[model samples]
Target chain A: MINQIRADMYRLTHSWGFYITLGLVVAYSFLITKSKSVGGIMVNGNQDALTRLSRENWTALDGIRGTTMSSSVLMYVLIGLFVIIIGYEFSQQTYKNTLISGISRFQFITAKYVMLLISILITIAAYFATVIAVSLILGRHVGTSWAHLMSTTGITTIAVAFFISIVFSIAILTLIVTNSVVISSILIVIFPLAVATIHIFADWNWLKYIDFFGVSNDVSLGKLTISQFGPYLLTCAIILVVCIGVSLLTIREKEL
Target chain B: MTETILDFNNVSKKFGRFQALDSVSFEIKRGDVYGLIGENGAGKTTIMKLITKLSPLRHGSISLFGETTGHYQQALKRTGAMIESPAAFGNLTVDQNLKVIAKQNGIQSKNAIDDAISFVGLEKKRKTKAKHLSLGQRQRLGLAFAILPHPDFLILDEPINGLDPSGIIEIRKLLYKLNHERQTTILISSHILSELYQVSTKFGFIHHGKFIKQLTKAELDKEKQSGIRLEVNDVAKAAEVLDNAKIKPFSVSNNHSIFVQTNQLDTGKLSQLLIMNGVELNGMTKQEGSLEQYYTTLLKQTDEGEK
Candidate 1:
């Protein structure tokens, strides 16, 4: 399993898709940070107004909001990672090269899952670091101390990671079952928005658990009380476990 | 007796409504180049897939190196395969593509990778992406990938499908080297029967997902009938003359040649008879049967028996 992971890491890092996706992540990070800090700072007719806009300060709250908002968008953007890492193997038939080498199906899937989580975390970290740096440079008054900023951002980031991890696991399962990148991509893009839209008209508490973007809103705002948070996480955990189980079963005896 | 490198016992596979393989059983022994022969969709690729576990082996049993437990990952570790077409990451360079394979197999020696690259004559294209390679080069790359692990057993399906004439000879020589020097047992299948005939020590003929026959090369040679071959100026005239004389079971093989399958064939008398009949026999020699004839005859017998 470790050997599989090591080989996968080499393949991932060498892939052009990895670099292109990472570049997009960095570019998106800059855009999100700039917008969150320089809201309505577009040049007006007056020179004085433009000068004053440049002097305005950004707060730690601005950085946290930018990072959390980007995380929600990042979930959609990172769909390509799964396509490259897992779907490409099936489409290109490259997985046969590894599987025929005496590696078990369980180890192959488990190694890929591990790589997916690690790559996602790396991109999330990059987004977080970029947002903080950009905000610090723009902010004249961050806070009396950096403690509150660090702790809040840290907690929010963890929540967002947990949310995104569950969502990505669902995407992996979809890719595995369908084995078509186009179908997986289309379904992944539609699933969240569809759930969120349905939850609005239906107005069911249970419906909110799977409405990924809606859950992200609550998570970003730190609005979940212990009572609400427990069930929400429990539901997501169940979905995650089911996805993993189904993913394994789908490929267990597949001809390819 | 030689050790068995691979054994298949009553293996069967079905894809939905179609049965791909039905209780096919065969074995490849150590130091043997076992050529798998069949028409298209005759369970050749299916058998390779089952051996490599590309397709699930649900109905029967397959054992490698005497191990039959749980898909035999440990036993498979000593084997290598390139099935159907070569599977490669088109975006990766030849070296990088092989590095992924090497890493997965836990081969730490850089020399092994270099040697495989040179062995397949792809050293010049090591830095080129797989997509940029010609079909022949890609085929060689697949062969290199299979042999890189220095496997105890190798499974190749149509390894010469894309090669030029010279390329075919090179691969044949490489197979001979692997079998002679390394004693690597091989299970290979190809549509080109003559090429297969040159390399294989043993043969297995499959038809309609069943093993029709299995024999060694010497046994096949003995099984093929010997006859008189005449190259004539006019094949039709020679055939007419032979028919008039009631020559038993002679076939005009081509535009200029006729073959007579007779145990009592007298080359001198046959040549003189053709010339005297004004058929103009240009040459006469004894001929052994070809792989094409053997396979065709076998298929005809099998089909007739089924009826």
Candidate 2:
């Protein structure tokens, strides 16, 4: 197991795609945090809109962690990054040679997931750092209670929300469903946009809660609750479980 | 003579309607250089995938080093291969590629990495990017990767597929050296039978994913279906002489020369009888079999299916 993990990480890490992704994200984080042009989002600043964003996340490092765990966190970089790591294996024809390396499909699949997980944690952490640094610099200049700006519950809520969101779950799903990177990336990205539209215009408000795009408004991260299955929350739960189930099933049976 | 390094029983793999391998069976003993040959779509790669557990067996069991399919890591880890392409990150150097593979297989020491590099004659190109290397160089790097862990059961599918002549020679030399020095049992395939013929001690001719025949060099050399050659004045008269003499299974080429099937025929007797029958007699001698001829014969037999 250790051997397989070592090999898988080596293969993924040595890839130019992996490093290029980290570099790009790091660059993005730096730019997003430092850029002075927040010509600003059209805010109805409706207590509801602020409530939604506020409930989704809280950060000590406003410039870094806040942006790090932003609802778009997974979508911005991880979608492309995960595809390069996992989806490329089957699409690029590299997996043909890799299979004969004397490793089983299960080990390979699990190792790949682990690598993605570690990548997510590390990159998000970097993004969080930028937020924190900016928050500190601005807090000193602007005179705000940076410490009281967030509750522990707020941070944990954001982490778990991102975890349960479509990024990791759908990335693994696409790994099994399509097996090809380019197709998977397009499908994964496009499905959410279409769903987001449905959630806005169609009667499928049920779907926002289902799995593709239901995010909580005021869930406490530090106060992690044993999820009470509401319709929206239930949809999220079912889809997340089903997607992971499908991923494992395909990995177990699908041809390498 | 040694332990069974690999075995397959009635393995069949199907890709939708097209069957890649059909009921293939073979056993490879330890330390043997086993050569596999077949035309395109003959299922050579499929069988290699089965043995290495790259792809699961569809209808049969494949055991490596005596372990069954379900728990193949130990057995598979003992095996190595360069199935299709020797692909790697375009930016990684040859040594880096070897090290990564070595580490992946649980080999931590740098000495093993260096040893693998030297084994493929790529020691000089260690610092060169694998993508920058020529096709032959990539082939060498692949060979180096396969052997880096010192695996006992090695499978190389068309390992020399894209090599220049010099590259082919170097790979062949490396294979020969491996078999001699490390006694690693190898199963390598090539559509060009001649390439496989060089280093393989035994040959298995496969067609449409079925095992046609397994022949040793000694058996091929001795039986001599391609045994004798003769120059005859009259091809028809020579045919009649051969018929009358009950010398069966000889081929008469367009040049009017006959290739007799066995060494037991008396060339002098054949010539005299043809001359007596008012046929011209020119010359006669023995023939050695080429790998291509043997392969064609085996494939033809499989095509005929004992009919």
Candidate 3:
């Protein structure tokens, strides 16, 4: 398993798609910070139409955490990463080479999951660093202390990392089952919307507990208490386990 | 007393309502180039998949290197395969593609990769991407990947699929070299039976997922009809001399050859008789049956038995 993971890392580093997607994630962070500083998104030629906060009152930590919180937008980047990491193998049928090289289905899928986790960590770090660099260069006020900013941004990074993991786990499971990147990407994009749509139609308070995307929105990392964060973590854990489990099972039965 | 490299015992497979492999069983021993002969959709690839565990085995047992108990990971470590089409990352260069496999196999030596590339005659194309390669080059790339690990056993399905005549001969020699030098046991399937005949030491005939026959090259040679073929100076005179010698069922195939379908023919007696009768005998030898004819005849018998 370790060797498989090592080989995958070598492939990942060599892949143009990985570097391109990482660059996109960083570029997106810069764009988001720049746009947020310019008052907000333009709506019908009005620059302040969606302006809810003033940049003068925001801190560098806020800039970084704010970009991380928009994991909804970041999910698409994760999809691209997943496509490169997992989808390409299935499409090219190259996974058979790995398996026939003595790697088991369990090790193969586990290695891919680990690689996804690594990519999420790297993307999170890059996104955070980009937001910070852009904020400093754009002359945003340091409204918070460095210690406070680091702690809060650290917490938000973890939360966002957890969120991306849950999202890409679904992508991994779907990719393994269907062996189609397009289909897996569709499901990845549609899953949050589907969950949100279901909650809207049912109007059930209990749905919020399962609506990870909705709950993720309310996660103001530094402000949340233990009781509030525990359930989210638990839900993320359950979903990750289920996705990993199902992926392993289905891959074994898949006629490669 | 040779070691068994692979064994399929009463293995069967079904895809929904379609039966792909039906209680099929065969064995490949050490140093044996086992040719798996079957028509299209005759479960050749299915059997390859089963042996490699690409498709899960539901009915019977498959022992690789005498380990049938577990997932065969340890046993598979010493095995290499290129089943179906040659699969590779189109974006990666041939060297990089092979490097990925080398990494997976924990082979830290770059020499192994170079050796495989040169062995498959892809030394000049090592830097070319697999997608940019010709079909024959891709086939060679697949072979290079399979042999990279220096495996004790190899399972190749149509490994010569896209090769030209010379390329086919090169791969054939490569297989022979692998068997002779490395003692690599092989289970190969190809539509080209004559090529298979040139290399394989043993053979398994399959039809409709059933193992119809399993025989060695020598057994196959004996099973096939053999007859004496004589290249004479005068075909008509040879026919007359053979006729006077009470040699029934002799034929003048062309202007200079007479085919005698008799295993009991006295060559010395015939040569003397033909010489005395003014028929110059150039050469005389026994001709073995062709793989195509034997395969066709076997399929016919199998179909008749089914009916």
Model 1, range A21-61, lDDT digits (tens) per residue?
Answer: 78887778777667652331111112342243345444555
Candidate 2 per-residue lDDT, tens place, A84-197, comes to 556666665555545566666656666666666666666655554555566455542322354543443245334533553445666678767776676666665665456655
- Superior by TM-score: candidate 1 or candidate 2: 1
TM-score of every candidate = 0.88, 0.84, 0.87
Rank the models by lDDT, top first.
3, 1, 2
Residue B123, model 2: Cα distance from true site in angstroms? 2.2
Give fnat for candidates 1, 2 and onward, in order.
0.85, 0.55, 0.73
Candidate 1, superposed: residue stretches over 4 Å from native: A37-57, A144-148, A213-220, A225-228, B229-259, B262-266, B273-286
The lDDT per prediction is 0.80, 0.67, 0.82
Greater DockQ among 2 and 3 belongs to 3
**B55-148 per-residue lDDT for model 2 (tens digits):** 6566988888889877776787778888777766556788777876776778878899888887778878999987799888888887887888
Worst 10 residues of 2 chain A by lDDT: A37-46
Evaluated on the second chain alone, the candidates' TM-scores are 0.87, 0.88, 0.83
- DockQ, structure candidate 1: 0.71
The TM-score ranking, best first, is 1, 3, 2
Recovery fraction of native interface contacts for candidate 3? 0.73
How high a TM-score does candidate 1 get? 0.88
Steric clash pairs (candidate 3)? none
lDDT of 3 by residue, A42-65 (tens): 111122312433434555765764
Q: Deviation in angstroms for B302 in model 3?
A: 2.2
